[model samples]
Target: VKRIIALPGEHVAIRNGAVYINGQRLIEPYLSEPTLWRGMTLDHEYVVEPGHVFVMGDNRNNSSDSRVFGAVPLSSIVGKAWVTYWPPDEVQVLTTPAYAFQ
Candidate 1:
């Protein structure tokens, strides 16, 4: 699963171990560590299409998401992830994070 990083018509870029939206650094309080990985999109800036969204894995340094496949069409998303069951002790219902674009 992936987190929607950039909404339609938004610009996303990654540099210096952080994700930036438009020209402002994105405030990601849920991330366990700084995003230091680079992939197809991380090396440059990209704009999400009108019906698409940019997605990234929570495990930034080890995920293959929009950074590798480009933006995903909204229609392609079938469901919202509401629970995480892995790692046993860390499992719980997921809550939507209030993103603060810095």
Candidate 2:
């Protein structure tokens, strides 16, 4: 799944299938083109509310997330997803993107 690379109050957008934040393109080396945004419901015009998170899946086309159900309140985020314990090949510690904190 994709991570919460950016948070509330951050401007986010998808253009030509690439993600950008605050007027800068995000360096999502993990993703390739054809990253489908099939089920996304969060239009770029919507502002992420304070204390809420906007999340999407790595497999963009198939995800059911904030883009569909709207931003997730920070209170609803029970904990951070620290590791991928399942799928041996995908297991690793999660690193929040640096731009996410800007």
Candidate 3:
């Protein structure tokens, strides 16, 4: 699963291992490490289409998400993340994070 980093019409960029949306650095408290990989759309400033959103994996270093595939069409998203069952110890219901853009 991936986190939606940019909304429709928003500009996204990756620099110095951080994500910027519309020129504002995104505050991501859930990331275990900084994003170290780059991809086609995220390599430089990219504008999200009106019907698309930019997504990224929590484990940025190893995930092959929007960084590789580009912004995902909103209609293409089939399901929401419901729970985390892997590793047993961390199993729990998932909730959408609230983001405050400055």
Candidate 4:
């Protein structure tokens, strides 16, 4: 699965267990449960550098993403996953979330 959270030059931050971009809180309605982000970066504010992105897994507790490996270069992203067909029983088309940025 590929997650495109923060883009180059975007400011990402975590406060009270939620994500904020460019000082606006991001709304992720697709999440099955709330995210308790405890990533490798503890600076509170993460300014995504040029040609890089910040990635993370839905299962924050079990995911090791850019938080651990640092920002990922834009050149490395292959593509986005448009559908989910795993677990056999659970399969469906994926739609992009409309994050409420304030």
CA shift of 73, model 1, Å: 0.8
Q: Using TM-score, rank the candidates from best to worst.
A: 1, 3, 4, 2
- The most accurate candidate by lDDT is 1
How high a TM-score does candidate 1 get? 0.87
What residue runs in model 1 are displaced by over 4 Å at the alpha carbon? 40-43
Taken over the whole model, the C-alpha lDDT of each candidate is: 0.86, 0.67, 0.84, 0.78
Cα lDDT tens digits, model 1, 39-85, are: 45446888899999999999988998888788999999988999989
Deviation from native of the Cα of residue 28 in model 4, angstroms: 0.9
Candidate 2 residue-wise lDDT, 13-76, digit = tens: 6666666677676777666554444555334544678998778787777778766777788888
Least accurate 10 contiguous residues by lDDT in model 4? 34-43
Tens digit of lDDT per residue, candidate 4, span 46-78?
889999999988876567887667789989989
- Per-prediction TM-score to the true structure, in the order listed: 0.87, 0.72, 0.87, 0.85
Q: What is the lDDT of residue 100 in candidate 2?
A: 33
Would you list the clashing residue pairs of candidate 3? none
Model 4: colliding residue pairs: none
User: Candidate 1 clashing pairs?
Assistant: none
Query: Candidate 4, 59: how far from true, in Å?
Result: 1.2
